[model samples]
Target: MCVSVCVSHGICRSLSLCVYIYSNTHSGGGLRWQMAEFTHLVVVKFKEEVVVEDIIKGLEELVSQVDIVKSFVWGKDIESMEMLRQGFTHAFMMTFGSKDDFTAFQTHPNHMQFSATFSAAIEKIVLLDFPVVAFKTPQ
Candidate 1:
């Protein structure tokens, strides 16, 4: 099972100890070994005036220019009952075969350029990198 806890800055020291215990028991080598690959969930909150079409256009242009992006899916937020409450207006789910592939994407010039272009349109952003643990169904 995967779990995450977001903590405020002041409580980080105390929360980190709890995070460490949970991570050590739940996310060690044995857990990591079960994954097929990992994915980076790039969640972005756009400015009020930014439309979904504009975001899609920007992402299409961005992905076309980047080589390190193995595969990606970009979309607007959907209604959900989950606690996260779809805070981000847009989401880009990108998959990489390995950590090296992801690292290359992070440092690639194309990505940097894209970020420069896209950052001005965003109000807030959050990125969560999660490992693929136990895919019971075939991809």
Candidate 2:
């Protein structure tokens, strides 16, 4: 059996939230995700007087240099609804192919340096990770 995976713009197009991947043909052509992915979700509230722009830029640059980072996104809170008071003003979502990849990204020198600075400037944060068991998207 052989598989043809889709890679778009260096991103595994098949590896987004709730999306499915197909590979390894049986008697009929089909696809499957060879491995599950890990998601690292982080929310942070900057301390007073901290330069939020610099922090975001540093984090973006740090993750870009880590080869294990399959996908990464960061942004400020949208503040759409009235009950959206989580206090964490920024969010980051990063996906990795495996725990090893996640660890590699975490331990990368650039990440280490960023963490050192981020830890000091953030007043509060919430970090959570979980394996993506299933993902779905609407048309």
> Which one is best on lDDT?
2
- Candidate 1: what lDDT? 0.63
Residue pairs in steric clash, candidate 2?
18-135, 18-136, 22-31, 22-32, 23-31, 23-32
In candidate 1, what are the lDDT values of residues 1-139, reduced to their tens digit? 4554434223232232112111233434343223334589877877888776876787777777776565788776677544675566668887665667788888888778777767888888888887555413232
The C-alpha RMSD of each candidate to the native structure, in angstroms, is 12.3, 6.6
Give, for candidate 2, the lowest lDDT window spanning 10 residues. 1-10
Highest-scoring model, TM-score = 2
List the candidate 2 regions with Cα displacement exceeding 4 Å. 1-11, 14-35, 80-84
